[model samples]
Target chain A: MTWQPELDELRAREAEARKLGGADKIARQHAGGRLTVRERIEGVVDPGSFHEVGAIAGQAEYAPDGTLKRLTPSNCVMGRAQVDGRPVVVVGDDFTVRGGSADATIREKPIMAERMAHDLRLPIIRIIEGSGGGGSVKTIETTGRANLPGGVGGTQLYHYTGANLSVVPVVGLGLGSVAGLGAARLAASHYSVMTKETSAMFVAGPPVVKRLGEDLTKQELGGWEIQTKAGAVDHAVESEAEAFDCARRFLSYLPASVHALPPVTTPTDDPARREEKLFTHIPRDRRRVYQMRPIINAVVDQGSFFEMGRMFGRSIITGLARLNGKPVALMASDPFFYGGSWTADACAKIIRFVDLAETFHLPVVYLQDCPGFMVGLAAEKAATIRLGVRAMAAVNQTTVPWCTMIIRNAFGVAGVVHQPANRYSPRYAWLSARWGSLPLEGGIEAAYAADMAEAEDPAAKLAEIEERLNRLRSPFRTAEAFWVEEIIDPRDTRRLLCEFADLAWPLLTPAPSGLRMRP
Target chain B: MAESPITIRAEIGASVWKILATPGAAVGEEEPILILESMKMEIPVVAPHDGVVVEILVAEGQQVEEGQAVATFRR
Candidate 1:
């Protein structure tokens, strides 16, 4: 009569179901080095936080005597759990049950999970494994029918998740072989991760790919390394634990849904705390390359930069850095890389980075040293202009505080786009700013081409023109004309930037905007 | 037979941008040697070591490249 008896019976049923198809089948799963659905859930979520929605519901099988041999619930686990004390809905596909084919996938579980997330407005974490509800050969035999080309269930889930994406942050953890719908689900997330050892996501597996005359391993076909580097997945972690940690960190910067603003954490550093090193961070010699990291480190709160897409955009550095403990998006030109030239990749990276900052209400601090967009035939072929314009659009569209510091080379359209509108521009600063059409080295020949051609002493005339242009090209001239703000010493950069941060902090008003489109 | 020592040299004379390899780290012949920054230009020091990097003679920010002995390793 006690409720404990019902719980005991349910536990017994699950154990008996696990023994379905005998000990040999269970051993095979063990040999593959995979944990069961329950085990995976336990590994990912906080310990003892999982509360299952459907435990005893599974597939129905029969014996030769025409009697029910076993009652196996759906091959997926759905539940609510607390990750870092924040409520989250979790779903994991159980590969042991018919490889998680669409035939055995119960309609109720996924719908229930999706609805729960939508109604409660909690983050939905889908632990995708197996083929993600694709119709199997056995499905036709079992149903005595074939699934229609576009099934209602698959369509419904797609639309539902797509709509929810703009409303809430959806995270996907690809923990095993994922194909078709599973791959799409992973792609739909704001942030996604795949395990290095056992997880992969592709349209089809190796066997299907081999039929089309291509041989590839599961890892090569859809490995985490390949996907993450290509930006198909945001992260590739060594283990499930690492993937879980990434999800937690990602969610820390976002609210439960678009309706709510991101929660702000108190800063550990004083708003006025300034480092003196920034003054001398940029070298006096234009030919010498100085480290930009030190300059960024000195300006931001100590140990607050969390870089994103560090490898993809070498010329432009993008990361989250705190000023007076308030999170701000830090984007700077690494002059060491192609003279801080905006390449196609760097442009695309900036577009996405700025979009994320705007979406999450993070103010942007641009430490400008941009020389210009990469030139030449190769740059044009790479669609550098198209991408560069988009990067500019993202920066301009952002309502968040947009502070800019012209630390060095600021030339051409690439340099001009660094600052927002003069009125809304986040308190602008110029430290020995080099502003012009381009650097003197490349333009000197063009500017004096006629003079050199006319002069009997061509070399001497060229030198004379270069010397005159260099004098006029100095930042002091620009400051005198008021083309730029005050031109301060490199050593005063930290204090100036800290002051800028203070001025911009009061202007940062939280917005309830949803995730913006990534370029 | 023992492999010959691979000598790492700078391609240009500028400040060191970054050191991607450390002593005893395995590197491919085509991998980034050392990143050099000159005139705000990043020139990679390609791996001379088809084996482990035996030593790193230069620290980051040290100006050296173009024939400067940055590191030597047994191939």
Candidate 2:
């Protein structure tokens, strides 16, 4: 009388989908020592907080009596879940079912997951194991159809991928071999994590690429090593548990969505705790190189400087660090590496890192110690100037609050990328700062190359030329012109940065920016 | 577990101004292990981690080329 039979039928179909390609496939997944889709969600989010939707959207087989038969679930399982008590939409790949391919590609599952994150104004976590919502060559055979690449309403995914960059934090966790659309989703994220032991992300799998005759495993081709170095992925971990922990930690620094201000933790380190070592840390001697890392550590909140892509761009250091426990994106030039010059790789790193800071509304703190763009035949061949200009464009486009502390040697075009162009920096300060068309040594050598060649005592003439130019290159001379804003005691940097953070807080937009952010 | 060694290298051609680390001495990450004077600038070869100095390869006043090993740290 109550239609209990139909309700029971609904339960039966859900149970079938939950089995995930039946006992055989689930066993294989376990044999691989991997968690299923539901398990990943369980491990990633709070206990018993997962409220799933579209659970039985897979194709169904019916019996003669019209009762439900075996079912195949859509490989994508999307739902609302709580990660550390805040709501986030979790879209996972159920690899046990059709290898997490779009065999029963109910396209709405992924689109809805994305739309849910945007509509609900919550952060989205993608647990991508395979091409769950992605395409494959075999899709033409499976669905008996073919289509153009990212064409015809591909704009749907584009809207979220671009919009969410400024609207909400999108985190991607690549846990297995990810291809096609899977690779796109991973790269689209503001932050990405991969499991070193199991995860691989690429446009196509090794088999499709076998024609090249490169016998490489999935990891060898697109593992964390390759992707992270390429700046396609942000972080890597030894296990899925560690990856989840990183995701949670990263979210803790950001708001659930851009509609809210980024969370600010109470400072455990004193805002006015002057690092006395800094007094002598950056030696007054212009020719000596001191480690930039120590000065950074001293100024930032203890244990809060989380560096990103350290090895890829050695000259420029980019990371998220807390000043007075307020998160800020920090970029500093390391004097030891190429004299803190910007190379093509460093320029690319800047583009990505600045995009990250702008998308998430983090104020940028640039420790500008650049000696300028890398020069010589190598630099020209690498298109250093072209990419440096592109980097300048990225900096110019960023609307975030930026403060630059010119430490030393801000010489050429690369130095200008420290802050937004055509605008006064909110709080631009200098410490042991030096700036000009070029450093005295290099400038003199190049400009007086002919003069030195013509002089009989070339060495003496060069020395005299450098002595005459040296006075103009002094940082104090630039300050006298009022070109530089302020020269402060190095020890006071921590206090000043804290003040700037508080000052910049009110300027941050408390809602999704009206515009969009592209990767 | 034994602390793996991290080698400290000279990033530019310079004459070693001073040796800041001694065997078994405690050092903080980014603290200078040695100072190299080049281009009229003083550059510090710093430790990469909180560790004890394990060995010193170059002596004070020694000339070292770029990427030359200067010291090692057990971190």
Write down the RMSD of all candidates, one decimal each. Answer: 6.1, 4.7
Please give the lDDT score at residue B28 for candidate 2: 94
Off by over 4 Å in 1: A1-36, A62-71, A100-103, A136-150, A211-213, A285-291, A335-337, A430-432, A445-449, A455-463, A488-511, A514-519, B1-40, B46-75
Task: Give the DockQ-based CAPRI class for model 2.
Answer: acceptable
> At residue A357, what lDDT does model 2 achieve?
81
Instruction: Write candidate 1's Cα lDDT for A250-303 as tens digits.
Output: 776666765565555676766556567665666676765666888888777777
Q: Which residue window of length 10 is worst by lDDT in model 2 chain A?
A: A510-519
Best by TM-score: 2
Expressed as tens digits, the lDDT of each residue in A1-519 for candidate 2 is: 599988887888888888887788878887876778888999998999999989989988889998666788888898999988999999898888778876555777888889999889889998988875436667888768885655677567656766677778898999988888788888888778898888899988788788778778898889987888677888888988988887887787788777777788898998888988988877676666668888889889998887777756667898888988899999998877667889888898898888778777888998888878987666799899898998999888887789888877777788767789867675455567777777767678788889989999998998999888876666677678888767888788888888888888888987555446666
C-alpha lDDT (0 to 100) for residue A336 of candidate 2: 71
- What docking class should model 1 receive? incorrect
Instruction: Determine which window of 10 residues in candidate 1 chain A has minimal summed lDDT.
Output: A510-519
